[model samples]
Target: MSVTAPAPKRIELSLPALHPEQERILRESSRFNVIRAGRRFGKSTLGRHVLMNAALQMAPVAWVAPTYKRLTPQWREICATLNPVIARRSEEEKHIDLIGHGGEIDFWSCDGGGFPGEGRKYKLIVCDEVAMLGSDLERIWTRSLRPCLTDLQGGAWFLSTSKAASSYFTQMYSWGQGERPEWKSWQMRTADNPYILPSEIAAAKQDLPAAAFLQEFEGDAVSFSGSVFTNLEQAIVDAPLPEQYERWAQQRSWMAPETEFFIGCDWAGAGRRAGGDFTAFVTMAKDGTICAIERFKADFALQRVRLAGLVSRFRPAAVLAEENSIGAPMLSALRASGISVQGWTATNATKHKAVEALALGFEEGRVKIYDVENRAVLLAELMSFEATSLPNGMTRFAAPSGGHDDLVVACFLAYLASHRPRVGECAWSPI
Candidate 1:
C-alpha cells in the first residue's frame, strides 16, 4: 500500500504592489512596530500583510480595531486577498484557518462597551487606527492584549493617522522611537503613497480646514492656543433656564409666533467612510438662548432624516447649514424632502464673522446655554477654537487639530441666522 504524501503546502496569494515605505516596514526587525501615517497611506494594507505573514509562519493572530463595525472592511480585504489559502472561515466569530498551516487569524473589535477577547493568547496582534481607539487603549493593551503575547514572545503592530500631539498614539510613538528597545516607529504622509495623486493632496490641502488638513494629510500632531471664547463663564453658561426648557423648545405647540428658533447644522458626508465627521445641530431662540443641541455621527441620508424630524418638531424659523461639499448636497436633499434649509458657504470671512458674532453674544452675556452636558461640549469646543493671523494678513479661525468644532460651528450658524439685522436694526446694535 502506497500512501500519497499530502499535497505540498501550496500557497497562492496576490496583493497590491508594496511601496518602498511598506517594504521598509516589512523588512524591519522590531518586535513592536508603530506606524504614524496620514490617512490613505496604505497602513491597513501593510498591516494585513504583516498579519498574514505571521499566520503563514504558523502563528496565531488577531487583528483588532476600536469596534467590530470598523473591522468589517479589513475582514473583507483579508478574505478577498487570501481566498485560495483559507481552508475555512467563520463570519460570526471572524476567524479564518489557513490551509496546510497550523495557523489562524481572528478579527475582533476591542469591544469597548463589552468584553474584548481577553483570555486567548496570540502570536501576532495588529491594532489598526490606534489613535481613534479613544482613551481606553492603554487599558485594552496593558490589561488585556499584552498578556496574550507572553507565551509566544509574540510581536505587535500599531497603525494610526495623526490626531493630536497629546493623544496616546503619539505618546506611544515617542516612547517606541526612544526608550523602548523592543519597539520602533515610522512616520509618513498621505502624499508619500505612490497610488495617491499629488493634485489630490494639493486639493485636499486647499479644501480642508487648516488644522484638519495638517492632521489628515501631513500626519502632524498639532497643538495650539487656549479657548477662543474669552467671555465664556460658568456664571453665564450654567445659568438655569425655565422648567423643562428643552422639551418646551423642542415641541412646536409650546412655541410662540414671535419666539423664533433657528437651527444650525454641520452635516457629515454621505457616510462613505467610517469614523467620519459628525453632523451637529444647535437650536437657538431669537434672543440667543440655546434650547437644544444634538450631534449625530451618521451618513447624509440618516442625518437628513434626523433633520427632517427636528424641523417638524421645532418648526424652526430658519435652518442655517454649511454649504460646502457635503452641506450643499445635503441642503438640496433636505429641500427635496420638503424642509426649507438655507446654506451658508464657509470661507475665511464668513467663518470669522459668524464666530465673532457668537463671541460678541457671549461677551454681552446674551447667550444663555442650557443642559449641563451639552453646555460642557459647546464650552469645550469654544475654548479650543483659535484665531491665527498668517504672514499675509489673513486670519484663520478653527479648532485644534484632531479636535472637533462641529458644535461650535452649529452654534455660530444658529446665532448668525437668528441675530440677522431687523429691517431697521443697526449692525452695531447690542447683541
Candidate 2:
C-alpha cells in the first residue's frame, strides 16, 4: 500500500492541491459534466472543490452515491471542510445548513431506484461512482434524477470508474467530445496522478485482466471483450407477446397455456459459499423464446415449493438441472415432490456444446426473449458472459469476476432442454 502524509493538527476549510488534469476539469464550463477517472486520480478531491465552491456561494447542492455506505467518508470530509460555516447539521438525515454562506448541502443515496431525491431540487448534483448503479443507471437518471435538476435549471456531475454492463456512461463521455452542447467530459488515468507511483500502476496491470485494468486503472469505458454470446440484443423483444398465445396479463408476465415450455433449473449451494448466488429458473418455449425467468435464494424446502409451483403452472415438458454437488439431491427432492426433473453434469465439453447452440440461436435470429425490468438481470449476465481460451484448446465459460452467471447457465439449460431431449443424463445435439 502507498503511504500517505499525516494530517496537520489544525483543520482548515481549504481545497487540496489538484494535479493538472484535475485542475483542468475543475474549471470546465459545462452544464452536465461526466468524468471518467481511474482509481486514485483525485476524483474525490476535485469533487470536494466543486462542492466547496457551490456551498461557499450558498448554492443548494447535493452529493449522491449508488449506495449509502460509500457516502460516509465523503460526508465526513465535506462536513469538516465547511465546519466553521455550518449553521446546522443533521447526522441522521445527512444534511447540513451553512451559516456564513446560507448554503445547504444534502447527502442522498440512489439505493432505491432514485426515490431518495424525489420532491427535491438542487442547483448542482454530484453523482459519485455512477457506474456502480449498473444497468438501472439510465432509468434512474432519465426517469427520476434528471427532473430534480430541471426546477432549479441546475447541472450535474456524473463521475465514476467504468463499472457497468451498458455503455451509458461512455455515451455521455462521447457527448462531451463534441457530440452535444452543454456537456463536457474528461478521462483521467491513475498514472496522471503524480502521487500514484508508476510501479503501482504497473503492478495493477499485471494483477488485473486487460479489460478490468482498462476500466479500473485507465478509466477506459470498455464493454466486455470475451463475451461468449454475441448479438444478445438482437434477440431481445422489447414488447410483451400478444395475449392470444400469452398466459399472463401483466406486462412481461409469463403465460403460454396453449404451448409447450421448458424449465431450466440452476441450483445454488445450500449455504456452501459466503454470498453465494441465487438458484435461477429459466422457462423457455420450444421456439427459443423465453416465457418467464425467476430467481431466488432459499433453503431446500423453500426451493422445492417454488419449483413445484412453476411446475404446476407450465407443466413443462421437461425439467433440466445442473447435476453437481447440491444439484443431485435437489433433483431427487424435486422428483420426490412429484416433479419429474432430469440432471445434467456440467463438463467443459457439455457446456461448450450447450452454449454454442444458444449462441447459434442468436446468430440465426431464432432466440427471442421479453425485455422485462427484472429481465435486466439475465441480460446483464448474458452481456458480460466471458469465454477464456485454455492451453488445452478448450474454452471456459463464466461471468466476469465479482458477477453472477447462474441466470446465463439456466438460460442455456432451458435452451438445451427445448432442443435436446434425453431420458436420464443430458446429452447434447445441435439444434
* lDDT value, residue 343 of candidate 1: 78
Best by TM-score: 1
lDDT to native, each model: 0.76, 0.76
Off by over 4 Å in 2: 1-12, 227-431
**In candidate 1, what are the lDDT values of residues 340-377, reduced to their tens digit?**
77779888889867876776677657788865447778
Candidate 2, residues 1-431, lDDT tens digits: the string is 99898874453565677788887897874999888889888887777778778877788888988788988889999988788778899999999998755589999887765648776888888888877676557777787778888988888888888655244777788889889999999988989899999999998776554555677888876643465566778888989754533453122233443266788988777222434679889888777788778888887778778877776666677788888888888877776666788888888889867877777676667778876435889988888888754322245677778888888888999889888744542222111
Worst 10 residues of 2 by lDDT: 422-431
Model 2 TM-score, 2 decimals: 0.54
Model 1 TM-score on a 0 to 1 scale: 0.58
TM-scores for every predicted model: 0.58, 0.54
Count of clashing residue pairs in every prediction? 1, 1
- Model 1 Cα RMSD, 1 decimal: 15.2
